[model samples]
Target: MIRRSRWVACAGPFLFPWGEAGSRRVYGLVASLAAAGYDVVVAGGGPEPLTTTALPGIDGPGSVSHIGLSEKPPPDAGPLASSIQTLLRWGQRTVRWLDAQPTRPSHVLVHGGQAQYMFHLQRWCRRNRVPLIVDVVDWFNGRHVRGGYLGPLHASMKLALHHYYPRCDGIIAISSYLENHYRRTDKPILRVPPTLDVKNLTVDARQTVDDSSPLRLVYAGNPHGNRKDLLGTVIEAVGHIQREGASVELRVYGPTLDDVRHLFDGRPLPDGVRCLGRLPQAQVAGALQEADFSVLVRRPERAADAGFSTKFCESLASGTPVIANLTSDMGRYLRPNLEGLVCRDHSLAEVTEAFRTAARLSGAQRSLMRQAARSQALESFDYRAYAEPLGSFFRNWD
Candidate 1:
């Protein structure tokens, strides 16, 4: 039986209902916490505060209270002056919100990005005897240039890594790479992937394939920052197979043909690849459901391993197997032939061979792969599956 627990307050990172990766990740996490029997109240950066909002993509099968941290602009202030004032306001408001809680939180999960947020939460947790867990999503150590406009922000984040995280009672990481990077002997850590709603990703398994039709492979992200997906290598491999008369078509999303050309430094996309303009999230789900496979190859690097891929998990959930190369902890889950083709490395030859195998999958084989993909998504990415694990992770502290 799941033991009912006190509240887990998530503070300052993703904007609830709609934010980027951080928002999406926190949604899955709090939902899992709720499933594990912890009452969760999440705060996001939004235009206004709400008592409750629709749980995005995953949750407690209902809404949760949300607090917005967007402060009124410091009018008549210069750039530096305005930033300082705005940040101060956000910090003050965050502490006030936390203090205003009906009861003190039993546990707190806060992203370690904003120092003002961290300092206040640390003080609060220390005072209340509540455990504070740092949500370690992205590491800024290697990704940035360290000399640009983001220099100070980057330094601040790095300082948090060396200072705040090590002092925290526990670490909740998004990948094995991050878990390992932030792991300490004194603290416990759990690695969770960016999760999705398995029901939304459900696609009817295809019973038959038209032999004459080209194999459809969807690449649904901007190529500008591939996180080492090796877009050039992926396109080249597909183009080579096309030149050999293989019947395969690549649909590129999130970038128009012109945008593609511009992003690729005036280079044209290979003949077999078609640039499909960006679509709404719901529309993208439809596109993923219709595809034979999704291309998710990434090179071995800190950027690739440090963060898990939300797109990859979504594809599997949509019953579209990924033509993936193991970079992060993907090797932990990807079952070759059962899920999708796996490349041994990022070389052109290896990628070409992976594509060649994908093109050769028979209709029945594709159907089985589709079923297996969804099954993996449910087992690996769904929040419900992690309830027990999350429960255990916290129970030890008590």
Candidate 2:
């Protein structure tokens, strides 16, 4: 029997195998590490049961432990308070759990957390002489907070980041924007973006475009306050395209029709627009494979600059091109007319023109673009490619 290395991954409070992009990234990392012959224990807080079926591709599901810290808090608690309390409890339980293990972990990997709890974890790791690698997935500053009521909380969190990030043993950034922002003394900073299990994503060889068939466009994600304006802009742009006599159909998943209506202030949906409620991963993958293009946009803000979109990677892996605005490090990977169309200003006219350009592409051109999209995924976003680098990094800590 092969002796496997053990690792403990501390992620935020989320049900395993959920639709949230950050949770999916954590799952992918755990599964990849397990596949690479590491015994990974995912510790977090959630009510959902974590079963073998929840982790489909992982080997020895019994070896991978799921340690739940506490039940999710009710909605009455403010967002900042809830996050702080959850991380506090999770950090406490995680330290106790580590003490009970027969052997200490080779290293500890923390995905995201509150500043105080993360600092506490850092101190514990230092005392135990264990390597602690922090993954920076988002800017934890005030940009994510919607109203001005949480200004003080956001400011304190920002202060925490200033003190917390520089003390970690190593840092893993998800985008160039974050890489540039969090460059403290010469610690090992790896740019590991959102990764996809490319082997599982079945690529369609058949062309999605048919001159006679209406252009099929798909968008899947939640409509948070930060994302609402961009989503509304896309919807209005779709309406413009339809009115110009373009046979385009936009199918939106992850938000109900009523939700979208509410975003539009109860305005009726235009023709060729359909809102399908949240879907399972398998169904969303199928929709992407069958669509001509996927649409994504982010406004110019600190929050937008700090992270990359996982939907963009999924779309490309499904052999579908994208129509996205240039934000963060997205331009580094996607090129206009090669992988997909890009909107420069994200203005209504620019987005509408992008849709028109995509609609005008010939069948052969679209097929090549789809191939390029898949190639990009295989080259840059595959999770298997990350395993070796991450494993080597942990091993060298000794």
Candidate 3:
């Protein structure tokens, strides 16, 4: 399977290889697409000036040419000047690949960035006869910045602009909600939830859960940006069970202790809850692999449906079942008594009951679930699983 096609991606708002959740998704996409044989190039917004780097490849057999695009403006640059500068960067870097490279890009996939930049990119792709695919991952309506009076209005406008799909040729949705939101459109849609490297997926690190040791639960992600509102509820539920003498421990993995403390309004965390603070990805993976379950129980809301939980897939990758509720298209993938357990909802009563359910599971039963989780990761979340499908999907655009 050889492909001469080149696919360039715009890594909006995220720095390649090092940014948060969105960056990892872009990395996975690049890896999968490259394995599919396309020459994948990623242009990411960074605080620094536009330049190429010697970063190692996540793109399996191939290497990704990473060009850092400065998202930050010069201190004295006006908005108009900044926008013009950005347009020039795109035109010079992505659009003019034909001048310096042997082949023009067949597709331009946007993870997202500034609205002005996206609008221009869309128009150019249309004029140049290139397919423009928007990766619709999140739709949180909160104001993205701390701007003064116009913050709300600006945020709303940005949010709305991202959802305006009339100009887009295709969509790579992170959830069913996002995919279906644009289902009426004539554009092609591909639902790709949080995916990771699965080549070395091994559940052997997780052994039988012992009744003597605590039933460990891990949560890894932004504490507030994603409205990890249910984290407090999870803490309380675990506290309640601990009071009842259940052996359990909840681990918080993303935010620093100070940040977590501030988010909880200076309130104390419940017993059996440990704020491990922002940890290295390796440590987070180690914790997840050792845990009985990873947690992602958000309340049912539009924000919840707008995107999938990357941590949920991470849990599966670590062979850890999740104590989660259905949001996005998560319910479809979770098997209640198998790879993962889903809560009916994210309320206190339901969350408490979910904890009890885990408490009741025997060591062997939990081991079976862990094995199921590893299988699920290998079957569904592996980058390789999407390589052929994405190849076929992009090939059809021609």
Query: Pick by TM-score: which candidate is best?
Result: 2
Per-model TM values vs. the true structure: 0.87, 0.88, 0.85
Assess candidate 3 and give its lDDT. 0.71
**Model 3 regions lying over 4 Å from their true place:** 1-5, 10-13, 47-62, 73-102, 143-164, 201-206, 262-265
Model 1 agreement with the true structure over 166-199: per-residue lDDT tens digits: 7888998888888887765468888888875675
**lDDT score of residue 283 within candidate 2:** 76
The list of candidate 1 runs beyond 4 A from truth reads 1-5, 54-63, 71-78, 85-90, 112-116, 141-150, 225-228, 396-398
Candidate 2 worst ten-residue window by lDDT: 53-62
Per-residue accuracy of model 2 over 51-71 as CA lDDT, tens digit each:
433455444322455666553
The candidates, ranked best first by TM-score, are: 2, 1, 3
C-alpha displacement of 389 in model 1, angstroms?
Answer: 1.5
TM-score of 2: 0.88
lDDT of 2: 0.73
Off by over 4 Å in 2: 1-6, 47-64, 74-84, 87-90, 141-143, 146-156, 226-229
In the order shown, what is each candidate's alpha-carbon RMSD? Answer: 3.7, 3.4, 4.0
